[model samples]
Target: MGENKNIILALVLSGIILFGYQYFIAGPRIEAQRQYEALQAEQAAIEGTENAGVIEQDDAPSLPLAVSVDPQTDQSSSGNYTYADAKTIAINNAELSGSISLGGARFDNLFLANHNVELNGEEKVQLLVPANEDNGYFVRFGWTAVDASISADDLPKATTIWTSSDTELTPQSPVLLRWTNAAGIEFLIKIELDEQFMFTVTQTVNNTSGNPIQVRPYGFIDRKQEPVTDGLFVLHEGPIGVFDDNLEEQTYEDLRDADGGKFESTTSVGGWMGITDKYWMTVLIPDQAKQLAVSNLSYKASGGYRASYLEKAASVPAGGSFETQTQLYAGAKIVETIDNYQDEFGIKLFDRSIDWGWLYFLTKPFFAGIHFLFGLTGNFGVAILLFTVVVKLVLFPLANKSYVSMSHMKDAQPKMKALQERYKDDRQKLQQEMMAFYKKEKINPLAGCLPILIQMPIFFALYKVLYVTIEMRHQPFFGWIQDLSVADPVTPLNLFGLIPFDPPAVIAIGIWPILMGVTMWLQQKLNPQTNMDPTQQKIMAFLPIIFTFIMARFSAGLVIYWTWNNLLSITQQWYIMRKESARRAAKAANKA
Candidate 1:
């Protein structure tokens, strides 16, 4: 009894210590960091920093001309030039429709034709925007001078106006742009679009005026601002790419902390790199088996980030043409689309653009199984329900034994209490007697914890899949559950959308979370762990409400899966308990 009290005291102290550290230490540190970052952002904004919204890559063969298109901006580092109104060239494909700006030959204005901005809404999902606009995000393909003597004006700068041969760019029809430099170099850029979001850009230069010129082909995607992410802990929503056959992620904060706000990799091959949002990504993939310099750069001036890669320098002799091809992926990060592109284009680890995290091996298979079930059931919610049933069936034998042990322990509870009272003054003897009693009944005190230990990994893996996989995004379940990847939108405080007022997050319990809590409470009631102390019993009773509140902000699909699993557990435990009770009753009758 004394030893048990010590154990209970230790557990309670541990919980208190953990809570105290989080509330008193970690919480304040996080808030202070947030405030500092906000202050820095505000100060930078007041100072009108140059390229404040631009994200760039460093260590490229040649640096892109840093030209500011903002008229009010006075930064002279970016060449001095008058900006012109950009003429738009339309691009139409099966999956998307957008336009390219002629002013700088930038692929700007793209929208996912299939994905809606809102659930069951008609607005198309916009992915890319012009560099000068808000959140100035767009992909630009151009050349940089390998020769230091080559004038910046001789190259196609951000404000360069090029003439396009075609009015529209389509998957079947590519658009070509031509520009001439007084230094006898004629630059040709061919932009080709696939049915999806992949853009093949071929940059060619012809030395027409007889002098040999050297230049390196370069491409970059620029986002003037960071994306608004759902959450920061689980999924990566910033600079992510494949380099040298390995996956790499650099968050916005990581970039800002890097020396000079730059990171570069020169030893990369057969891989691609780019920026990724929650459900969309824009990556630059150079030709495989080719040597390329890649970099992720952050700039305070533009208040954004950019991923750029440069290919080997090409020398165009008099009457000679030099050309290079690179691919641009800008659209939804659909799992199938990304994987297919990975196999088709040989983009190494392209599928990793999704934030699979460390437990990818487990999370991926779970997602695949659930995806297969989704196909069969046609609804993710129903598929989740079926998946729970399958998992329970697989664990039936282990759970059966565990329940039996728990039942035996519950049956011995009265005897345990009597021993405790008799040995109230003898702590060591009470423990010895309790052990003997457990041995006589063949009950394992720790058996009740086994099921939870077994289920923890599966629970986390399923949560990861539901949170990170784009397949779960906008996936519908039954009524009122529109997007499984997002928290249930209808809150109980608003009477499940019947009322107009939005409640505080504390009271914003969703239907699925509430159901999960109720199921948990029911399972606890059916569980035969009656030896728990009064404190433990109260904690167990409150666990349902605590878990419901904790999971209210999680993905609805995950809550549904957990709730279904709890119900199945309750069913199994209740049945087992009834059978045990009946058997005990029959034994008593026989003795009588």
Candidate 2:
């Protein structure tokens, strides 16, 4: 039997390594490799986009990075649209392109690495363009008009911007380009990048008309990235963001999220800003280091006011344009830094954030707070144990009740055995009688299990805490259990290097599982089963060995939880049993 159990343990060990490699390593490797090929394709695509303009003008920048709508060439040309139709904006650099539209005001485009765009409408007159677009649809928006410079105190107004496609881009004219002077109405608006990929562009209506006007902004810029799963952590805070040193150091040379150590990973503190038909991006992270609201991995968008959801009222005064500042972050979203940020911008990206009701609200915050406190202590294992103790203490009343009931139930096991023998044939009747007996004696068969069941969330939450958190990566502990993430080294894998499994955290060959199984068997004997039959007894005894096999290759953290829980439980049971035995003996002696 010992040999058979060792054989099973070996098989389980092999399976874990194989599964880890296949699911976590191999698959991501393949995807990252594929992304490398795609980034190369993006660079090649630029050639086709500029071929028309370059072929016409021999003096054009021989190499192509930015794509533009050529007014120098005829607009009648035709070609398939590719990502190269968009200019490659190095995430950390500031880039600007000024274009004078046909009989239009000169639009100066400025890109900041901190996820924001500043349109300095000086000397140039602003035009208010009504945004005509669909519901929940986000886009870049601006207006068209002759020079109409207006003063700040005067009612700011401008002519509507004509659109070839949808006039619904803005329900009314956007209020970004507010007039600083009375020199006609200077039209202006700004787009704020919300958390993650969501964009919120706002144009306030500043007016003394005693009424509020609401408008939406719209425009378009094509975005592209070769997808890769493996890299330093990624945080996508959309408007407000952050990044660790490792992630910030990535470059866009290959323009892919991941490469075969061949491509550079990059971050765009400022994403992309579209001016009229032209687009600009921040090529580097220089001045965009400090920020205002919605802090994430990168810096903040310090240029604008952090708008409120409820307090702002989401309304603008008529005749007066609304003023707002916006920031954008376009780059690989490092998940580790995002989680570490702990703000709303980072929290919304987690998969576990969407859990329901009171448990969802309470659990995530509770676990995160515990992690924060324990992470300070420099040991996750110790933190987990501390967290467990706190939870147990909070639920002590229920535990006390369960323990008392179990004390009664364990003492009655002899009587229950006698009843089973008496009603061996009438099983249904036996169950009814046993239930009545329990009610009469106030002995609960399910009492002890209740505390454990109630405590299951802490166990499961700790599992997620250990599995998902990158902080625990390669973290070491006392010898044998070097890494808390994996099980303690007790069993050998290769067994003389013959089998696939080798010694990991486990040190002793195969003693731990047998010992664990023995404890389980003893616990079962100490706790009585009132309504159980011969078949039930078989199952109860068999569970110990079954669980032993299951836990042999499990994580040290999980084993720690169970082992401590069981040992503590055993001590409690033994104390209660001894006291009860003494009490009965004393009562009998007094009666005699």
Query: Which has the greatest lDDT?
Result: 1
- Writing each residue's lDDT as its tens digit, candidate 1 over 1-592 gives 2333345455445445544554466556656766776876787788785654342321112433332121111112344332245577898999989898787787878999989988879999889976655456888887766654355557777767789768999988999999997777789999889988898889898888677777767887777776555434668888887777778888888888888676777667757778898888889988988977444445444367878777756787788999888889999988888889988988888878987878888887877888899999899888888888988999898888888887777778898889989999999999899889888889888777667667877787888888888787888888878788888778768777788898875568888888988998887667655555798667667767777776787789998999889888888888887888998899889999
lDDT of 2 by residue, 1-592 (tens): 1232334355445445644654466557757778777776676676564433221100101101121122111111222232222221111122211211111111112222332222222332211111110001112323211112321123221111211211111212221223332333334443323233222344444445454433222122211221232331211111211222212222322213233221111332322221111111111121133221111121112111110110111234455665443333222222333344324333222322212123445456555765665677777666666766666667767866776776677667788788879999999989998999899898776776676567656655554455444344445555555566554555544453457665532233333454566776777677634554576456556767666665665556656656656666566667766767787788779999
Q: Which model scores highest in TM-score?
A: 1
Give candidate 1's error at residue 313 in angstroms.
2.5
State how far residue 265 of model 1 sits from its true place (Å).
1.2
Clashes of each: 16, 82
Measured on C-alpha atoms, candidate 1 has an lDDT of: 0.76
